[model samples]
Target: MDLRDRTHWIFDLDGTLTVAVHDFAAFKASQGLPADRDILRGLETVSAQRATEIRTALRQWEADLAHAAVPGPGVIDLLEHLRGRGRQLAVLTRNTRANALRTLRAAGLHAFFDARDVAGRDSAAPKPAPDGLFRQLALWGAHPDEAVMVGDYLFDVVAGRAAGTATVLLDTHGRHGHPDSADLVFSELSELTSRLATQPPGQSIGGPHASQKS
Candidate 1:
C-alpha cells in the first residue's frame, strides 16, 4: 500500500499538476451552455453547428488559460521526485492533448513527460471512463496494481477507482470538498512530496492493499 513504491504514476492535469484555471460556471454561462451536467457530455446533445461554435470557443479559451497555467503547490518537486525514481508517468486529462502539452510546457514541466504519455480528451473517453488510464498502462505494459492516479476531484477519484489504480486526492485550497473519496488524501501536493521523499521502501502510505483486483 505504500504509494511511493508504485512504479507508474497517472496524474490529472488541471488541478493536480497545474492550478485549476477553468471556471466551468463562468465559461458555460458565457457560452450559453446548460449548467446541468458535464460540459463535454452536454456538447453531444447540441446542434452540430452549436457544438462547433462552443468547441472553437473552448479551444481558444483553453489555449489562453494553458499559457497562464501555474503549477499547484509543490507540484514541481513532486514530479521531480517521481521522475528521479525512474518510474513511468502519464497525464490523463479532460483537455485536448495539445492544450495539455502547452500547459505542461508553460508550467515548466514539459521535460518530465514524453508527449506520447499525455492522454487527453482527443485520445480517450475522458475522466470517469478509465479508457485513458487503460491505454497508458497498456503502452507501458504496466498493471493497474503498479500505478497510482493522483487528482483533485470526484471524477478523478471515480476514474482512478474504475481504472483499478490506487487514487490520491490532492485537495489543495479545499476545492475537492469531499470526504473518504480517495485511497489517500493530501491537502497539498507538498505534503505528498514530503511523504514520498521520506518514506522508507515498502512502507505503506495507507490502505491495506496496492491496487490488485479480486
Candidate 2:
C-alpha cells in the first residue's frame, strides 16, 4: 500500500534510522551471553544481579555508539518527505530514550521527531512485544491500521504484526527476512520513499517473495 499515506509512522532506531553499528556478537560475548541467543531474552535466563549488570553494560555500549551515530542512507530524504507531508512520526526502539535522542541528534534527525513521540525500552516492553507500538498508537489517537512499523529486523516485523499494523522490513542485505509478518520490504529507505511518492495511496507495492516457513 502507499505507506506514506499512513498517518502514523513508527520506526526502529538503531539499524533502521541510524546506520547499523552494533556488533551484536561481540556485545553478546561481552555480556557472557550465547551468540545465538537474543540479548534481552538471554538476560532472562541469568541471575537477577547478573541481568542487572548486563543491562548496565549494554546501556553503556549504546551510549558509546550514539556518539558516533550516522543516519542510514536515504534516512534524511525519507524523513523529510514524511515530514513535509505532515505525517505523524515517532521512534520505537529497544535503546534507552536518552541514547535514542543522542543518536538522533548526532545523526541530525532529532528535529523531525518530538521527544514525546519517542518510546524507548523504558517506556514500554521492548520490540517482539507490541506494547511500545501500542503505546505510540494510543498517544497519537490512532488505530493500528492507520500506522506502519518500519524496522530492519524480525522483532520489528513481529511486533508490528502483533500490533495489527502493516510492517515493512528494511532488508538492506536482500535476505528476504521476516516474510510472513512483513507486508512489504525495501532494500533502501529511498526505495520506500520512491514507491510511496509514485503510488496511489491504496495501491500495493510488489515485493520479491514472501517468507518460507520451516
Candidate 3:
C-alpha cells in the first residue's frame, strides 16, 4: 500500500477536488424548480423524470462553474509533489469532457493533464460503474495493481475498488461514511502529500484482485 510507488493517480472532480458551486441543487434553482426542493431528494426525482436533459443541464452548468473553481486547500502543492515524483495522473469525472476541460483550464490546471487523460462522460458509464476507470487503465497500459484512486465520495471508492485500484479517500469532513474498500483515508490533500513521503518507491499501490468480473 505504499503510495509513493504508485504510478498512476486517477482523481474525481466535484467534492473530491473542488467544492461544487453549481451542483444539482444550484442547477435546479437556476431552472426555477421549487426553491424549497430538498437538494438530495429532488435530484433522484428529477433524474428519473428527465434523465437526459437533467444530465445535459448539469454538465453545462458544471462547465460554466469550472471557470470559477477555486483550488481546494493544498491541491496545487500536492499535485506538484506527485508530479515531481514522476507519477502519471489523470482525472475521471462524470461530467462531459468539454466541461471537465473548461473547468481545469479555468483553474489554470489544464497543463497538468492531457485531453485523453481527462475522461469524463465521453469515456463510459460514470462512477459506481467502474467502466471509466477500466478504460483509463487500458489507455495507460497499466495493470490494476499499479494504480491508486484518490477521491472524496463513496462512488469513487466503489469504482476504484471495482477496478482493483487501492482507494485513497479524501475525507475532508472526517464525517463522510467510511468506505470498507478504502486502503487508506486522508483528511485533506496536505495529508496525502505528507503520507506519500513515507511510502517506498516502486511498491504497488493497488491490491491483487480481479477487475473485469465485477
Candidate 4:
C-alpha cells in the first residue's frame, strides 16, 4: 500500500536526524552493563530502578557532549522540503525532552519544530508503545490514517504501526530493514525530499523493489 493521504510527519531524533559521538555501547559499559547499545534490552535485564539510573546517567553524558551532535545526511534539505510542502513536523524520540531540545538547538533544527511537537522521555511510554505518537496526533488534530512515522529504528516503526500511521524506515545502511513492521523504507532521507517534490502526500514514490538487503 502507498502512503496516500499522510500529512503529519513524526520523526525520530537520534540516528534519524543527528549523529551522536557518544557511543551507546560505551555508555552501557560505563554503567557496568554490557558493551552493547541495546539499551532497552539492557534495561529489561536490570531492575527498573537501576535501568532508570542508567538511562539518566547516559542522558547526562549525552548532554555533556551535546556539542558533538551533528546533523545527519540530508536532514536540513528534508526538513526544508517538508516545511515547503506545509507538512506538520514533530519529533518523537526516546531521549529526554531536555536532551532532545538541546540537540535540536545545537544542530540548528530547533526552529523546524515546535516545543509541543517534540516528545521526549517521560512524555509518553517511549517508542514501541505508540503513546508519544498518539499524543502528538491527538494534539495536532490529525488522525492515524493521515499521518506518517519517519524513523530509523524498529521501535519507531512499531510505534507508528501501533498508532495507525504509515511507517517509513530510514535505512541508512541500504539494508531492507523491517524491524518495526514498517510499510515502506528509504535508504536516504534525501530521496524522500526528491519524491515529495514530484509526488503529493500519500502517493508511493519509491518502487516496491529498491536495493535494500532485508
TM-score of each: 0.92, 0.93, 0.80, 0.86
Candidate 1 runs further than 4 Å off: 201-203, 206-214
* Most lDDT-accurate candidate: 2
Best candidate (score: TM-score): 2
| Candidate 1 CA-lDDT value | 0.86
Error of 2 at 196 (Å): 1.0
RMSD of 3: 5.9
Error of 4 at 115 (Å): 0.8
Looking at model 3, the pairs that clash are: none
Output the lDDT of residue 59, model 3: 66
Model 4 spans > 4 angstroms off: 1-4, 20-22, 34-37, 47-53, 200-203, 208-214
Clashes of 3: 0
Mind giving the per-residue lDDT tens digits that candidate 3 earns over 136-211? 9999999888898888878788899899997888877766655355777766777678667654576543322211
lDDT of each: 0.86, 0.88, 0.75, 0.80
Candidate 2 structure, TM-score to reference:
0.93
Q: How do the residues 64-183 of candidate 2 rate in per-residue lDDT, one tens digit apiece? A: 999999999999999999898999999999999999999999999999999999889999999999999999998989999999999999999999989999898999997754465588
Worst lDDT run of 10 residues, candidate 4, spans 205-214
Residue 180 in model 1: lDDT: 69
**Could you tell me the lDDT of residue 99 within candidate 1?**
96
| Residues forming the 10-long window of minimal summed lDDT in candidate 2 | 205-214
Which pairs, if any, clash in model 4? 3-202, 4-202, 5-202, 176-213
For each of the candidates, the C-alpha root-mean-square deviation to the true structure, in angstroms, is 3.3, 2.7, 5.9, 3.2
TM-score of 4: 0.86
lDDT of model 2, residue 9: 92
